[model samples]
Target: MSQNSPTAPFSAAARPELTADPQRRLGVLLSHGFTGSPASMRPWAEYLAERGYGVEVPLLPGHGTSWQEMNTTGWADWHGAVEAAFTRLRADHDVVVVAGLSMGGALALRLAADHPDDVAAVVLVNPGINSTNKQLLALPVLKWLMPSMPAIGNDIKKPGGDEHGYERTPLKALASMLGGWRQVRADLAKVKAPVQVFRSVDDHVLDPSSVELITRHVPNASVTLLHDSFHVATIDNDAPRIYADSAEFIRSATGV
Candidate 1:
């Protein structure tokens, strides 16, 4: 699609790539959140790529485009994209680390659960596995009536930071996301990889219930608090902490 097209699958500012490094034996696959583009995860991917590690940041299907287009796709489409990237990285790298933000985190966890031996570790920032929002329960009926609700993008506290996600949230796509959330939570115990989570102290998008559910099920998961940032901590003030800590987690988990 043309970059200027309104229906383009990606934003002009967002640069998504499957970066391959033949010399690097380690790879990191980073996934962006639901309705969001690779723009949010680009900086994190660049950090790992600059350190000589292979990185893959794929744009989820139906995302980066308009919300109406996103409503046509489902969770399987998004997960399939991430799984493909992981499989490709596993073929080339000695070890692979999977990391994500929000809904992306749920996808990463699902990958670790499904392929325990292939994933070296998992890093999550403000993952959304469970929600206390009662409005979600009405999604099934609301999707047929209303096409979308308000946008949930650019929840970052930092100035001039934009996630480049959809301006509206498609209800049908959100219902599909809820299914993915339930499946991931059901298989949380199957995740054998070392998992590290970074949670924000003041998140406008997700509640603490999500974090509580994840830590309650996942075995020996470590949680860190981001005091200054909001939901999009990957681009907030605490982003450096996430980058540094995740690198350390990868090294310790993979023995690299």
Candidate 2:
């Protein structure tokens, strides 16, 4: 089942974004956070593609258009999108590394957990497997009464950084995602791939509990704290560090 990946050591400066060595079937699948579109993960995706790793960043269902539209969708829709993308990438590439941000982190974990042997590696940025928001416990009833509330996007510490996510939080969709986390928590121990987590010290969106749970359950997982970034660390001050480390992880994990 093992396959060969990129062999040349990863050097972002040496390889331009336009050129990808097609000699090896190495690939990466990047999923954006909730309420966000592919634009949120564009920079990272482009960097990976340019570095000669096949990259695919899919737009989740009911996102980018409006929060109201997202309210109509649920966890099943979003997860299904990423799952399909993974399947497609797997067919084209010999090995695929699954990565995501925020809710996308949970989605990626779900893939790694379910298809432990299939996923070559896992990369998560502020993954949310659990939450401290007690209000979410009441989602069973609240989702039907209200459609949405205030937004949770654009939590970047950088002045000009933007995730390009929704303006409002969709209640129905939020409840569905929260429910999905329960399954991820139970299956965390099932993840067999090497996991890398990039956590922001001052993230205003996600609680630290999810990171704690991830490190507690998953083996061969390492955490890197991001001091100058917030929840959206992919585009924050530590963006370069993420890119460099991610390339390094792929090189180390697959022995490419």
Candidate 3:
């Protein structure tokens, strides 16, 4: 996994889709966080796929490629990929649930806000909505001078688990992520789907304000606090809880 490699088609660890039962009519679209590949969401997707649900985990543009390539892309490119996946799921299923991790959560919220009738429910794990990091205030200026900063992946507390994300964080792409957060935050009221958010109490990557902002606006959004996980709770110790709770949430929301 070189940081200078060229962008290619989905790799074995990049994107994986599973078709459970053709007649299930229930679909799920799971998106990975910024700089992350489908590897992070594979386990969760598989869990649902094995239970007779159509699942698609897409690799966002510039991800699963190289950090340099990720630098060239923006939030629009990432959101576009997720939106396309969601559209495909809607076409084949009577009900669709959108779930994501970190920045992917922001994208899911955006989709729910834009297509409320299409999304049956929304589930997020350690979603990155707003950041309290002071460095972000200088992103507009820093992105012109510095191409990247330290990596922000692999925040899982479970040892040996990997998120398969970039080792370097691209500033320009990060600024674009922040822009998406701002947009989603403003339109949170437009999200009419049932929202279920899982927050890790010990997450080191995201600020508490992020979840606060989400619950404040999403009207009746349910928040589940993870006591024993870091930012990447999808692969952390509480992963099973997320899987089980989300499964129940989807079943209860859509009656599938």
Q: Once superposed on the true structure, which residue ranges of model 1 sit more than 4 Å away at CA?
A: 1-24
Per-residue lDDT of model 2, residues 69-185, tens digit only: 888898899889889888887887778899999999999999999998889999999998899989888888988998998888889988998777878899999888988899899
What clash pairs does model 1 have? none
> Each model's TM-score?
0.91, 0.91, 0.91
What tens digits encode model 3's per-residue C-alpha lDDT throughout 1-256?
Answer: 4422321222221112333334447888888898887777877877887767878888799988788999999999999999998888888777889999999999999999999888999999999889888878988999999999989678888888888788999989999999999999999999999999999999889989988998999995899999989988988899999998998898788777
Error of 1 at 230 (Å): 0.6
lDDT of each: 0.84, 0.84, 0.85
Local lDDT at 188 for model 2: 95
Could you tell me the TM-score of candidate 2? 0.91
What is the C-alpha local distance difference test score of candidate 3?
A: 0.85
Give the clash total for candidate 3: 0
